[model samples]
Target chain A: MRIGELARRSGVSVRALRYYEEQSLLDADRTPGGQRDYPDGAVDRVQLIQQLYAAGLSSRTIVELLPCVSTGTATQSMFDRLLTERDRIGVRMDELAQAKAKLDRVIEQVLAAGLTRDGATGSAPVGS
Target chain B: MRIGELARRSGVSVRALRYYEEQSLLDADRTPGGQRDYPDGAVDRVQLIQQLYAAGLSSRTIVELLPCVSTGTATQSMFDRLLTERDRIGVRMDELAQAKAKLDRVIEQVLAAGLTRDGATGSAPVGS
Candidate 1:
């Protein structure tokens, strides 16, 4: 498939696909006319890349992990590093959960305050 | 205190402090020598800005939300927007959790394989 089709199928932008190629996270073959041609498996590859990126892995780390993921021949050091990264993600998730709780508290306060103001002024409730 | 002191107290870099000022997420008074001087409250304000940023709010949204956080005077639209942003963070948290789980599974498989390899080849266990 062409880059456009890959982007559409992968739900990633063409520019991002190009960037993945630049980062060596994805590969494409050149056609006789010098246009980029992707294999059928490119869609799944792109999705996996997106998943790793969403996991907060840097391009360098993703590049290292991709080969190991496919081959299952990673060195001990790679596994150790991956474990560290996983722990970091765990910490980030906890922080995000805390932040979300804080936001919920603030949202509750705002809604409660709005309700009181509306009651006092006889105004219609917000978003009504 | 000066910008340097604010940065030190906030544990944010000086360049980032200037960036917050540029983004209008922070403010500073100027000394006669034109150095940026921050009030005592600036530490708390910078911490708040950091919290909002960690919640994945953009600088623009932070600017909109800060006044409400401090003064409790947000409009209904702003409140609605904040709720939406909070929900977005919730979704992101779920995604990160799933990603972490996936990483955990892969890490387990890698470790199991390494153990098998060590047993077969009489190699020392990885990281031992």
Candidate 2:
């Protein structure tokens, strides 16, 4: 497929796909006309790349991990580095979960306060 | 406390503190000598700001939410906006969690493959 089709299928922008190629996280073949051509599996590859990025892995780390993911032949050091990256992502997930809980608490308090004020004044709740 | 003390206490850098002020996410009073002086609550305020930022709220949204957070006098629009921001954070948290889980699965597969390869060769696991 072309870059546009890949972008649409992967739900990633063309610029980001180009960036992934620049980062060595992705690749594309050139046609006779010198246009980029992606394999059918490019969609899944791009989705995996997006997942790794969302997990907060840098492009460098993603580049390192992608080959190992495909071949399952990582060296000792590569395995250790990938484990460390996984741990970092775990830590980030915990932090984000905590932050979300805090936001939930604040939102509950604000809404409860609004409800109380509305009850006292016998008016519809704000934003209702 | 001065800006330096506030930054130290809040575990934020001086440059970030200055940026917070620039974004109106934080404020400091000017001393007679023109140094920035922060109130005792500034530390807590800065921590809250960091939490909101971690939750992916923009500086503009944080600025709008701060007053209501402190005073509990938000209008209907402000309340709705804040709720929307909170929901956005929730959605982001879900996405990050899914991404983390995907990473976990990949890591497990990689590690398990390494262990099997090591067993077959009767060698210590790679990176062990």
C-alpha TM-score for every candidate? 0.82, 0.85
Check candidate 1 and list the clashing pairs: none
Give candidate 1 misplaced runs (Cα > 4 Å): A115-128, B30-36, B115-128
Over B1-128, each residue of candidate 1 has an lDDT whose tens digit, in order, gives: 99888989999999999999999988888989999988999999998888878877899988987865775545667777778888988888888888788778888777666632422434334554
Query: Could you tell me how far off, in angstroms, the CA of residue B107 lies in candidate 2 after the best superposition?
Result: 2.1
Q: Which candidate comes out best when scored by TM-score?
A: 2
lDDT over C-alpha atoms for residue A88 of model 1:
86
lDDT of 2: 0.78
| Per-residue alpha-carbon lDDT of candidate 1 for residues A1-128, written as tens digits (9 for 90 to 100) | 99999999999999999999999999999999998999999999999899888878899998977765765545656777778888988888887887778778778777766632322434334554
lDDT tens digits by residue: candidate 2, B1-128: 99888889999999999999999888888999999988999998999899878777789988988876775556666778777887786677677777767656666776676643432434345455
Residue-pair clashes per candidate, as listed?
A: 0, 0
For candidate 2, chain B by itself scores a TM value of 0.84
lDDT tens readout by residue for model 2, A5-120: 99999999999999999998889999999989999999999999988787677898888778667665566666777778867866766766777677666667766766424224
